[model samples]
Target: MSTSSEHTFTSPFRNFSREEWKRLNGQLSHSIREEDLDQLHALNEPLTMQEIEEVYIPLAHLLELHISKFQELHASSNEFFKRNHQKLPFIIGIAGSVAVGKSTTARVLKKVLALLPSKPKVELVTTDGFLYPNKELIKRDILNRKGFPESYDTKKILRFLADIKSGKSQVTVPLYSHLEYDVLPNEKLVISQPDVLIVEGINVLQVNSRKNGVFVSDFFDYSIYVDADEKNIVSWYINRFESLRATAFQNSASYFHKYANLTTEESLAMAINIWNEINKPNLHQNILPTRYRADLILKKSAQHFVKRIKVRKI
Candidate 1:
């Protein structure tokens, strides 16, 4: 593992106003239309088009812009070195706290980016696949901290990214099960020559892969951190838990089947317990610390609508 202290960003960013965002990303928003809003099961509630225009659509354009700029940089470098050219992979990382609508953002981004004629082949691989199996987490006495950075196979994730970024024709990403609460056997997602790769997780931009080690983010061409207040995120988490109690958790195969039998009061308490005991702490110590490291931060409100956007100033 190498320290990220040695790595540096390649461009500047600005916190644009809604009007400014429209001017800069308007063309992209039109070019890459996100007609169907993907469902983020964790959201606990239904989504609206307001979220799409204000948050996801603008985000798609911003991402598309960066991808093109990064591609140009590749060509620029090739010309500068007087070498034959090839298309370098463009990687985009989307990071956020638990229940912050990041999964939905990732899904919508995947669909929207695929709309681009210039870069129709986009791949999305979640960090969920990198999570340690339930048995491993239990052995390590960290099952409660599943979404924390330490729960992921960071080294393997880095290797996968490095391989694909290096122009390897095929890269296989593991699959994880929501019902079993572990990585699935004999199930993997394969990617090849992707024009854009969207990596979504709670700590994608966190630089501390180890005390001193290279982060998976080192390979990202751009990054977005979905953010909201602690109270709001906690509320969302609780609501989601209750919703799942009536839906997914009711499945007999669900590891959280016990939650389905709980009263609304009990379910809320359990969700908050999980948050306070595990998710919130992970956010404070590991995830939120990386927010500033992202190329852009999409700030949301209590209602889950994106309220503001912060782009890192060069």
Candidate 2:
């Protein structure tokens, strides 16, 4: 179910040379529709052609390779299993810190992979869909730690994954509305079996296998972690919070109404406070600890773009 190519760069990082990076910058670009990327809240900073080439562009091309190989191997395995058993969907996990630009990475990868000749039907199912409804979090008194691994209905997520993997062509997943800050029970997003399934969120890979723990990550053909310094991520988080406040918070349904009305200084201060008190702590405790579990790691700089990549030597 695997084929080894003699490409000089085995992964994104090792393969990017000065000349090749420049060439990739000019040669490769996803057929990214502006509408498809409108959901991405950050990482759309006006970067130079060099920044696109040296960082985002190469990563785009690298993801293309990772996704193509993933589909090829998964299809072969599914066919083999069909001879004697049932088959399942190919799952993938994307995890990282609060402001590490993982969301943008996932969206970009989804766009890029979908454009792959072999995987036009790829599906990107985010764990945001699995977040427990706000009422449940408030009742449980864990409302403040909303993005922590414990904040989700992991069991439901496992069952959803299992259903898709069991060859259910289509499965329904809960939908989370950022405007309301909760999972909307009445709203369900249907996920069809796709050539590649990209599951992106803050904590998609934590599993307690010793306890027979069921996790979405356990079903993945591969996993990725986006990394950057804590300080840089904090800054990025604050910036994104401001951007969202100005944009999404303008809607009447935004749960952060109190935050939305704050003065510029007050809003900035509150954003940093939330970052330090909640999101950063979650990163240090729940998210960062899972770095070692990633099949590949994309390390980004303070500008929120990748600088180095570490792929587990298969």
Each prediction's TM-score against the native? 0.87, 0.81
Model 1 misplaced regions, further than 4 Å: 1-13, 17-20, 23-35, 38-42, 79-85, 117-119
Which candidate's TM-score is highest? 1
RMSD over all Cα atoms, model 2:
6.4
Model 2 residue 258 distance off true place after TM-score fit, in angstroms:
1.1
Q: What is the model-wide C-alpha lDDT for candidate 1?
A: 0.79
lDDT tens digits, residue span 108-188, model 2? 666656555554566788888888787898999999989887788888888887787777878998888878888887988
Residue-pair clash count for candidate 1: 1
